[model samples]
Target: MTPRIVYLATADARGHLMRAQLLVHALRQAGAQVDVITTSDAGQRFLAGFGIEASILSHHYAMQFDTRQNMLRGASNRNVLHYMVHPARMLRDLLRLRRTLRGKDILVNDSFHPAALFMGILPVARRKVVHVYGGSLREAVLGNFDGTKRRLFSHLFRHVVGWQIDAARARLEHDFSYAISDHAKGRDCSLPTPVQVAGPPPADGLNSAAIYLNPHFSDTNLAHALCEGIADAGLAAYCVGEGYAGNDGWVGVDPNWASRAAHAEVIVSAPGMAALSIAVVYGRPIILVLTEQPEQASNAKRATALGIAHQTVTWRGEAHDFRCQVRQAASTLRRMVPAPTAVSSGRLQAQARVDAWTVRLLALCGVQT
Candidate 1:
């Protein structure tokens, strides 16, 4: 009998779905039957494109803020609560999942702990793998908050979110937890074990479609301001992972990168791991911007450290500032001397290890590794 794997990933952001899609492809190649669960319309569209069958985990959330954003006590706090009132529904759904996932061979939760924990409660023989991407395990290592504020937030986290994550991990018997960033491992104060770092996919394929990784909501003024900036910057911008819809210069998000990279001069968005990877692969200059989320801020910082692109404040609205930054980045490209067009040694080593680990995982799961 073929081993079956159920993968759960929240559609809170496109990154979650994107990573899960990759996992599905790899799992299928390894000869495992895969079922993916996602929560957003964007996730559904992406799954359709991959021809993967996916189930939508529906919930009513007002504003989707992750762990870092939960620290701020006022507006951000209000935003979190206003959006997090699905406690009863969440418990109910978890119970339902527990009943439904009674005998899967494996359950993979890619940054979707709630569903993972629920499935763990079932009397199933499946192994649980909690796959964490860049933002999943950030608190312990990147404690950039002030000392007093850190302590206070730590207390809340330990008592509240920390306990929840702990319970989820404990219940699920999470055998192997994977982290996307080697830079993020052993950093989170909450977990005892360092997550096995699985570096992202290599930047090799050239995407033809001009792509935009928009994590921001489409309606917000800030999102609008930034989208407009991107439109004005040059290439078309995608909003909410859809093709350019606005009358402004921005082209909505299109996954079909069929020809965008070849035609467009640049790809502008927050410095996300996936976007950065795409930029690197396509050799496109990125306009890194800080977004409302702290994790985004951190990612942007890392991208700048990696010499990836131009970084700017979250609320960069001045047209002149945008123009100057773009011009400067373009100038830098012009003056750039040609280095050996080879993959960096560090990246090559990382890729080799990750490939080995993927094989190991497939073998352990009896998937013909």
Candidate 2:
């Protein structure tokens, strides 16, 4: 029998949407009927850009970020608390979710969603959930309490999250490398990050740098600095992200940004797992624009440690200072020896991981692959 799958994707970042897009495509191609529900209208539009239709669940939570893309912890905490405790919103969403899950074979939760996590506590829902997330998420949650102040809180939080993770029937924790093993279960396995395969490069040769910033980044001066830096490094720039549309000299929110990144000489973007995965699969050296976001910072650090040729730049309150840093990083990365076999090898590895994951997912849904 063909399995019916309900995928709940959070909209806090584009990574979740992209992951949903890729996995849903793969599952559909494998003959599973997949229905996607995202957290916000923005997410619905994003998926639409890729020719995927998704419904928006009105009860959604978002993290608070400053104009410069710094995560505002206190404000974010308050927001989550409100979303969790609001009686009307919570009750409405839970009822909607229960209805949605009815007759569905499995629920695939991409990253975390408070409502879905709550629903999974019920015996019926608990047996039908498959959670997908990156290792950086685990680090980010625990890393929040890293230094001298809250050791006990950190310890208790770790236990709580661990138990929460086990609420699902199966979990797929993905990362660039498989280094950590917690011995959860055979069903809970770690695998390489999954990314969409790039299409053939355009007829014109690949010589431009592709830049992507999430909707959270809205600083105009930083965009200008990036344009100047790319020009100074003597490379053409294709910039895409929210708030960049119609900007002078910016390509602005191109749906084909991934293809551009695939063929580009280098990639410039925040260190989101989706972007990082694209860079790795295409063997494109990247310049990571980092902020105080723990997940991104941890991803950048891990990318460097994994010997991926990359550079990091941060906003230091002045566009001039940032321009110089970007220019230097771009120039340095552009001159590095290109990995001739990296593209084929990387693509093969990603394809294998995705294929393995899809098979397991189908099996869990009681569909023979």
Leading candidate by TM-score = 2
TM-score (C-alpha, index-matched) for candidate 1:
0.66
List lDDT for all candidates, in order: 0.48, 0.80
Candidate 1: tens digits of C-alpha lDDT, residues 231-309: 4444344333343345344444444442243233455555555555545543455566555566666666666666764
Mind giving the per-residue lDDT tens digits that candidate 2 earns over 146-217? 674779987887776666678878888887655334342366878667777666665655357889888887
Count clashing residue pairs per candidate. Answer: 20, 0
Scored by lDDT, model 1 comes in at 0.48
lDDT of 2 at 8: 88
By TM-score, how accurate is candidate 2?
0.92
